[model samples]
Target: MKRFALFALFVLVAAVLTSCGLYNSKMASDPADVETVAVVEDAATEQAEETAEPVVAATEEVVEEAKPAEPQIFEPGSFESPDRCKNCHRDIYNDWKESMHAHAWTEKWYQQDFMMAHHETDGATDLLCGACHAPIAARTGQLPPADGSMFDETAKRGISCDFCHTVTGLDQMYNMGHVSEPGNEKKGPRGDGRSLYHGVKFNENHTKADFCGSCHMVIHPANGTHIIDTWQDWKTNWYGEQNITCQDCHMTPTPGVQETPGRAALLGKWRDNMPYHGFVGASSYVQDAMGNKKQAEMAREYLKSAAEMKLAETVAGDGNLALTVEVHNVGAGHKIPTGTTYIRIMWLEVIVTDATGKVVYSSGLVDEKNHVDPDAVFFRVQFRDADGNLTGKSWRAQGIGYDRRIPAKGMDSETYQIALPAKGEYQVSTRLMYRSFTQATLDEAAERTGEEYPPVESVEMAAAQTRVVF
Candidate 1:
């Protein structure tokens, strides 16, 4: 009886184990209910847990892999090159190549001055000059070191094809603070193009005065001084009120308005008027250096048109001759001589001549030192040192105590009364002069190079003749 009972117990245990094994095998095949089956079969459960974790992780990874990645934002520094544009737009490229804008940073004089500044300050402010000269170098994270050794070959080419076209956005006005969006989409005065590489060009900001203001208006970084405020003067006056753009006055061959007709690009359609890239301004020295006599003449004409002078009256008053002179900022959208205030000069000159073509008196004459005659009333911005002393060296200035810039589309007047013991027929003349370098600067250059070059000064004169009775 005991043996029979034991045999039955063994049979029941075998049946239970066989049923669990079969259920786990079916669960393993489906893999869907493996966890539940494994609960009843502990050995199968351990095996399912081990294989299922890896399979589940792999499935998640496959789902993630099915989606695409987002496109990258355009970067200006990554511009391929402007040589690509020359493949189609050969004429425009040639015109740009011959332009002073192309050689701005590469020019010898500019490079010399740049190197001198680097040497003098020990690289403290080389980037300041490079801000305009080599904006590409500055934007490409190549500057601030000021040595120019770390800059790429493309960046060393000064304002090249890539630099201007890659300007996708601007940071500010006058100092040429631009944000580059480098690619085939060349930004210019126009908005129409069919090239797939070029993106949509729809920003009227490119067509306004503010675009030029980015570089034309400059401020002293350390002292918070207004070194060059051409844009500010224009924005505060009639030019701003009339909606006159810098392009309107500057981009044209004419001093005041636009009339050019051409296509902006080879693939692009022809337009009635396109922005002329010559960018002629008041830089006769650069124009002359580039051997562009026509551009130099145009620059001189522009300077002549920039201001108009008028002599209102010349009379004897209380044994003194009284003369009234008026100067109007007629042409420029900003103050005349706006960029690099240290080098830009504007002064009033008055000459009193007697009969027989003999000169009686002269004011505003630049002396051997290139200094303005002390007796003359000069109109200019003055910088001051830390100790409150006046400084002609812009780099040494820590403060600006005075500015007499003529407001855009505005007028400034000065009166001179001189006592004359003997009266004769006197011819009174007034002149507005603009110079890129001071006399002292030229002298220093002569000293360094051991070669003498003539001091360059361009003058605009307004005169009136009157007879004084003795």
Candidate 2:
């Protein structure tokens, strides 16, 4: 009977594996390949630059057939799928289901970018991108040749339970050096908590911010430009000095909550800290468009907590209204609009009106196309390509020309001078606006997909108004 029971369990496991199209992977065995994280940080490194759009299938012509990417192989471990973990971690699983990480692999934006990279580089860039987008497939030999033709269902799960839990170690702060040994024995933060469903070993790296820094601190693969430096910024700031890890804000209920007491396992009693798994980030527009309402709201909440602004000075002088505004990065652990900051947009909009309601001056006016005015004080980085041309092509970025992004706990004092036609009780309104993508990208994507793209989510961080009396 015992033998029969074991055989039945084996059959069930085989069926699940076959149905999910699981395959053998050897990326874990080769630590070197796994460490070459594919983060294409493109910054405009020129004084004068033009806005360049990335080559996308929706806008650009796909004139090449991509050769399949060579699969990076590693020894497959006894890792259980996310569904199996859901048996005990129902709440955590549900939270992760609606997160951007869950859609990291199959999201339309990512798909467009990945396809563009594949076609541009003739499929050579697949594994680099796949290392973060599809770690399961990239490591399991499921995506050899970097093409998506051979991906299994498990690969579509994005950052899966097995891939995260199986991570055994990391090499450095940047890139994708996460070492995973997937299989029945799952590693975690719990020291003594054991599960009948799987084995568990406490991993100290799980408790550190650098653990999350594996894929967060991105660098240019060829030129070594520091593209995404959120981790590094925090490391050198007050937060890191106080030992405030990334998990404190991102993995907990509060954005910067230090820790919370809870049970690490299903049957265990309330112990110390237990991190949540939503893995939230600043991605409301995409998340809402992708039908994750809860995730979108959470993103909005994060943004609302990110910064605070106030109208510092308002004076009528020299036939003009001179005003000063103060914007402080108060809540976020990193800089506002941190990752993929080149594409991310943040700016200031100021409007001045007379007591009679006549418009005196206006900046940051949204055009009919839903784009911010070009001359507004924008907080964004512009990347340049190898030929010293400005472009949004992150994967091909070789230089950063201009980066106006606000840093952690930082403040920006912006002064605006507006010519007053008639300065009689002038009322000035100021606001700090945030959006995921520029209006141009949205329009291009809409034209290419033929599907009605969701509206550009322009969130207001803060607003204030003061009277300018002459």
Candidate 3:
């Protein structure tokens, strides 16, 4: 019985191995026949599958490309109407409306000068005074017509809020070469902001000297002659070295330097300090026009701080007095009376008084005809015509024959030597005077406009007094 059981188990194991394919070689003794059966099965399956399959084709995926960024376009309008800003920012708008920026376009003097330049140049206002007086109008293709009717109420206001806020980038330093990227991006001194309007705000660049340089430095487009390079002058001087921005000095109530704390907008967060928009400098004319006494005082203070005068003398045994007067450009970034160099006048006036208060000698004294003494040492720039003739007309100037421009933080000295009869106690005084225009030019301008031009008043930039008892 045990032998029979063992045999049965062995048989069961052999059957299981055959079914699992382990005993295929032993089961298929006729290999050729087995191969024929496999081939027939594969062929029958292929035919069955081919008959049941559909005739659809496989396709490739299609990717969509992204679109490019669009260029920004500015909306055409006037920001001159301070009433619009008053609706939102009442306090700031009130301050601005009372400031000189508001009257920049409508001022009587500016209108007269602009109209004269326009009338004489035959619609050439776009290249001349419009660069400063009506910057927005010129940029928006509204200028070349000084009549103001060509532009709307806002544009006629000159450098308005929308115009300044819309400035996207600067092409060069000065002379209205700024590029306008008009959009929702309101570039300012603060870069960090969240506004509904699609725009960016940066505080650093806007508060720097470069912002003021856009219009302060004027260069002739045709000749490449530097008409005004105030920005460059400041950059090359101590102001740049000290990291002093134009806004640091001009926009502060203290005149020189101070922190201005305020909010940029009503809904904006409060900043410890923000750049003010007063933009006060040495422009008494505009201050008077706007009836702003505080602004005029600020202008006077700026002029007063612009230079320093010193008198040094070397006496000889033969009663010859050699007086050296040094004038230092201390405050202004550009040449002492920078804009419209032809019209700007800067000169040194020396008065020697005896012990009795009688004037012994006087230089740079204006006569009844409003002519400066020819012998005076004048600190001014002279432009030359094509023929090398000195001409007061800046438009006709092709080259600069004499450029005694007072450099930024630079000192210029003039020596006057004269023989005195008998000097007891002499008081020598030196003064640096600045005027808007020459008498001849003002006379011509008055005659052309048939309006009595305002008298040119000289502001004492700096003065020095010394006592010499020999």
Worst 10 residues of 3 by lDDT: 58-67
Whole-model Cα lDDT of every candidate shown, in order: 0.58, 0.66, 0.60
Model 2: per-residue Cα lDDT over 93-207, one tens digit each: 8878777777878888777667656555555456556677788776766654555667667777888788888887875556565777666777777657767877878898878
Per-prediction backbone clash count: 12, 30, 9
Give per-residue CA lDDT, model 1, range 1-470, as digits (tens).
Answer: 00112223223322332233322434334333222211211111222223221211112232233221111223235645547667766766666665667777776656655665455445544555576677667665576466677777776767777666656566545345566666656676666666765665655667778776766665444443455666666776778888887778776777888678887667678878776666777777667766777777787888887887877664655557777778888877776656665555676788877776677677777666456554454445555444443444444445553455565777777777766556566666678877665555555555655655566655552334455543
For candidate 1, which ten residues in a row score worst on lDDT? 35-44
TM-score of each: 0.75, 0.82, 0.76
lDDT of 3 by residue, 74-134 (tens): 2246233545555655556656665667677877766766664444344443345565677
Please give the lDDT score for candidate 2: 0.66
Which lDDT value does model 2 have at 162?
Answer: 83
Q: For candidate 3, give the lDDT of residue 117.
A: 42
Best by lDDT: 2
C-alpha positional error of residue 35 in candidate 2 after TM-score superposition, expressed in Å: 30
Q: Give candidate 2 misplaced runs (Cα > 4 Å).
A: 1-72, 75-78, 144-147, 258-265, 314-317, 449-451
Candidate 3: deviation at residue 73, Å?
8.9
Off by over 4 Å in 1: 1-77, 80-84, 98-100, 172-176, 196-200, 317-319, 366-374, 421-423, 448-454, 461-470
Please say which candidate is ahead in TM-score: 1 or 2. 2
Name the regions of candidate 3 deviating beyond 4 angstroms.
Answer: 1-80, 98-100, 125-128, 183-185, 191-200, 266-268, 369-371
Cα RMSD (angstroms) for every candidate in the order listed? 29.1, 11.5, 35.0
TM-score leader: 2
